[model samples]
Target: MYSTSTQKREWTYTPEKLAAVRLETNIKFREKYESVITPEELELFVTPEEELRMQRSIEDAALKFADKFRPHIWPSVKWTALAFFKRAFLVWMVMMGCFYLAMKIDEFYITIDDFVKNMNVGDPRQNAERILKLEPELMKVLNYNLTVHCPYRPFEGHLMDMKTRMLLLNFDLESIRRDSMRFFQNALQTDVLLVYPPSQIALAAINFGCMLKSDEILREFLRKMIGIEEDSWSARDVRPEDLEKLEKTVTRVNHIMREVEKQFVAVTEQERENHKSRLSQIQNLLPILNERRKEAWRAGGCIGQEPGLVTEAPVDSDDE
Candidate 1:
């Protein structure tokens, strides 16, 4: 009965307890063998010790075999080692793929940053943190709009040519008219209102407004330009000569509009042959007139100056 009870108690030991006993026995056995062997021959007769050394040797051999092993060795130990190597290689491949994807994402971000910096009206680098949040497509759109609509003095040459060829020739006239009008409006809202002038913004708005036959915006912009000229004057001194010159400009613009209207009337009244011939003559003359206007503005050095433009309001010392 006592032997049976002891056997039942041994059998009742849990898996956890049994594993702990095995680990303890292994440790004790290793310690005993290490103590018996001479430090020199400790490399030799220990079963667990020799088994560990053999395992390390096998691993090294497997690594060397894996390096040289080929697919031709079908049912051999070298093939078995190759299988282990292939599994390790598959894991490495997956890791490399993930790393490449991450790098591509980083590259996309850098491209977007460069585009925004290039397109910015002000120093885009100054707003690097904010600009980084914008997508690449939005940056492209902004750049396109700015290039097409923003007026710089350099663009005056191009605009003059485009206007004469497109407007007077009446080639894609409606599209040109619409683009010119929208460009003028965008220039006014973006360049004029936002940035200090005499800048490309104001120049672009003025030129576009003039091209589109938008009399109201054109007149307003001209008035603003005149105001700039006034502010540039040392005092409120309105020289009679300057005033006369300003009046002459206003008259000239009005006369040009009248001429355009008269030409339209004549085209309606005349025979097709006469009308076509007259329109051709007008087109030939338009480029010469455009060049003359550009030269006059250039000689006067009044290309960007508004007659009475004020960049900012004067601060009152009394307020401070």
Candidate 2:
């Protein structure tokens, strides 16, 4: 005999509660029939007519039990039962099949989105950095492909080549700085595969400068890159067109090498000055860079030959 609470409430029951009830019922039946009925006799007792009656009794008991405790059993039992049914082998197989089909439907869209997002038209370095962070193997593949397919300028080719080399080198900070400088010099001399403004170039230089412990140069580069002229070419309006012109004006590999030499001098560490071996490497690289810059200047002479190519639209004095 069980007492029903007058307090009407929502139902909830745990698996343990149901299991306890089943165990208790099994024990009671065993206690009541064990002395009078042997196992064989008990089996015989459940004849077809008796079996039907027992089934009805079980059903009635279950209904009564549910009615009495439904409020207490509604929450966990409902979800648990649903989960059990949902994860049945046949049900799970069907669900998985549907899920796979849905993925297949949008597979092409997903591929396109991935390509566009990764191959974004902004700075290749930014894209490479992001891809290297997220999917290093994929970045490696891209680096390899770019190196193989594109070999127009050796310095630019080497700059593109460094992505894989950097991944492999595991270099110290000093080495990384040196390599990054070399790469940037090479990058600047090449034809604009991706058109970036001086501001963007300045940003990259600043980032690289910071990494190289050259905060002063970084700041200066940022100022120049963003068109805040101090002394050199101060009167020139540094517009987007000016930046594009600058790109064309520096087409010779030599021009890039000279700028690289200038930047290297601007950014080299005072502490690193005492390191003879490193200093010698820097010294060796300087002449090479200057020669490259001269070559670049000669190549880009055609652009410079056109007067007003570097000049840009005047800034509004009233707006300023």
Candidate 3:
């Protein structure tokens, strides 16, 4: 089912490809304004890495924002909101807007006025208008494909499997479930969602949970799951290639967890303020730069042909 899903078909990317795409976007943004703006002004634009860091902070803030709602937002809806926010190329200003759209798509409707009032941001009316105006752009960016398959479901499945299949460990499954879910939550802060399957991520969460409980138990569980015998390299039922792939997936997920631990710190208020100012400056300058681009294109005769004028004929235009 996952293999046939749109996420696997269209949204997934390897780390190198993901980094390359980000770098290309970074370069493209710089090129867009390079000729129009001064070098000092150009330096103010954030790099792809900086943008990612800011996004991570925004993600945490978005979760906090959702907590303000009166009736609790569904966990699935929150997951979908986070997915939309990550997929849509957005800044801090539109973070709430994206989440609002996610809630709508997920059929968890909240009135705009109520939403804005709860947000407690500047100008409730303006916030409502901004959210409405940006809705179309977010939909366009997502290609109107709203389905997001999160790891939570598969996570539960894996837990069920472990409870029944790997009985020898005799560990308390309920105790690790909370930690597994926590690790899964932390996975969102990294690129693992884009780079790996949800099922693999769920298993990785289990691996982390087990590792925390006991490394020896973790190893035994992995050996059994991967079908590796104590005396030989051969697997029991899992294909050699499949086993290799699973090993790599688990290793990469663990690596991402470690990296996130080292790199993702709680975003400070001052840093967020600076990010907002920088984003605001960039937004203010984009229009001027775009107009200059258009002017240059027109001057160079590079503009496309304008729509041809319609002419009246013997037959009525409407009839044709």
Model 3 C-alpha lDDT per residue in residues 142-247, reported as the tens digit of each score? 6666677888888788788778766776668778877776776676667777778887777777777887677565445556666666566445644677567656
Worst lDDT run of 10 residues, candidate 1, spans 90-99
lDDT (10s digit) by residue, model 1, range 115-198: 333332446564453434332323232221111112233235444544553343423423444454344322221112121222
TM-score of each: 0.20, 0.15, 0.79
For each candidate, C-alpha RMSD in Å?
42.3, 39.0, 7.2
Error of 1 at 104 (Å): 50
Extract clashing residue pairs from model 3. Answer: none
lDDT (Cα) of model 3: 0.71
Score residue 229 of candidate 1 by CA lDDT: 52
Candidate achieving higher lDDT, 1 or 3? 3
Clashes of each: 14, 15, 0
Q: Considering lDDT, where higher is better, how would the candidates rank from best to worst? A: 3, 1, 2
CA lDDT for candidate 1 = 0.35
